[model samples]
Structures are given as C-alpha cells and as structure tokens.
Target: MDEPRGDYWYNLVTGKVEVGAQSDWTQLIGPYASREEAEHAIEKVHERNRSWEQGEED
Candidate 1:
C-alpha cells in the first residue's frame, strides 16, 4: 500500500528546499521522490535541457 509523506519542493525565488509547499505553486519545482533529488532540481532540469538540445535523449 502507498503511504503518504511530505514531498520535497525547490522554491525558485528563495532557492530553498522545503519539505512541503510553503510558497505559491508557481514558484516551486517539485514533488520529487527524495529530498536529495529535489535539492538538485535546477541542475537536473538544466542537464535534461542540455541533453534534449544535443539530441542525447534520442
């Protein structure tokens, strides 16, 4: 069974890692599976964008 837990979020404005929503939805990045992953959310997004631009995801 799935258990409920507080999700992680990256606040774009303050560049903070939150255990749950503390800011407006438009200013956050995620509900990442883990805190560590959420902490690197921006880097992850940038990496994915780079891969896509280079067709590395193909």
Candidate 2:
C-alpha cells in the first residue's frame, strides 16, 4: 500500500487546518501527521501540559 506524506498545520489565529505549509510558520500549531489530528491541536496542547504537570509532581 502507498502511504501519504505531508505535514498538517493548525492555524491559531484563524482556527483553521492546513496541509503542508499553507500558511506562515508563526501562526501554525504543527507538523501533525493528519488533518484530524491538527484539528484537535488545542486539546492536544492541554493534554500535553497536563502530562508535564503530572510529571513535575512525581
């Protein structure tokens, strides 16, 4: 099977999803593998922060 190759970006300012450098780097969240993953960028950030906090507490 063929695989898809591209980076996904979530626009913080416009609350949008982009594929492969659609907008400037400063406005984007990531480099995520899929559009769906990019769409949940905010949630992922929060989750990551929580993990970091938990780690610090340990």
Candidate 3:
C-alpha cells in the first residue's frame, strides 16, 4: 500500500506551514497545497494583527 499524503497543518511555533503525520506543538487547522499559500494566509492575518491594537490606542 502507498502512504497517503495526509493532512497538512500550519505551524505557529515555526511560523511556517508543514505537512506530515504529527500534531502536538503544531496546530492542525487545515491543509494547504503549498508553502506560498500558507505564507499568504499568515501574511493576511499579520496584516490585521496590529489593526485592533493601533485603533484602540489611537
């Protein structure tokens, strides 16, 4: 039998997405096709990370 590709998850600790058969310190939110895709998602989140912080203090 062939090994499955399995599900990929985003690694918040490493700040990079990885695919494998392991989950613990890593967060398995969902799967992404490529690292670029995952990075883009992270970037989007970061873009908004400071929005609330800045708004409240302003």
TM-score of each: 0.75, 0.69, 0.45
Q: Report backbone clashes per prediction.
A: 0, 0, 0
What lDDT does the true structure give each of the candidates? Answer: 0.84, 0.84, 0.61
Which model, 1 or 3, shows the larger TM-score?
Answer: 1
RMSD vs true structure, all candidates:
4.8, 3.5, 4.5
Q: List model 2 lDDT by residue over 1-58, tens digit each.
A: 6335458889998898877777888998888888788899988899999999999999
Task: List model 1 lDDT by residue over 1-58, tens digit each.
Answer: 6423549899999988888888999999998777787889999989999988889646
**Per-residue C-alpha lDDT of model 3 across residues 1-57, encoded as one tens digit per residue:** 632343455776666666662567445545665555655666666778878788989
Clashing pairs in 3: none
- The 10-residue segment with the lowest total lDDT in model 2: 1-10
Candidate with the greatest TM-score versus the true structure = 1
Off by over 4 Å in 2: 1-5
RMSD of 1: 4.8
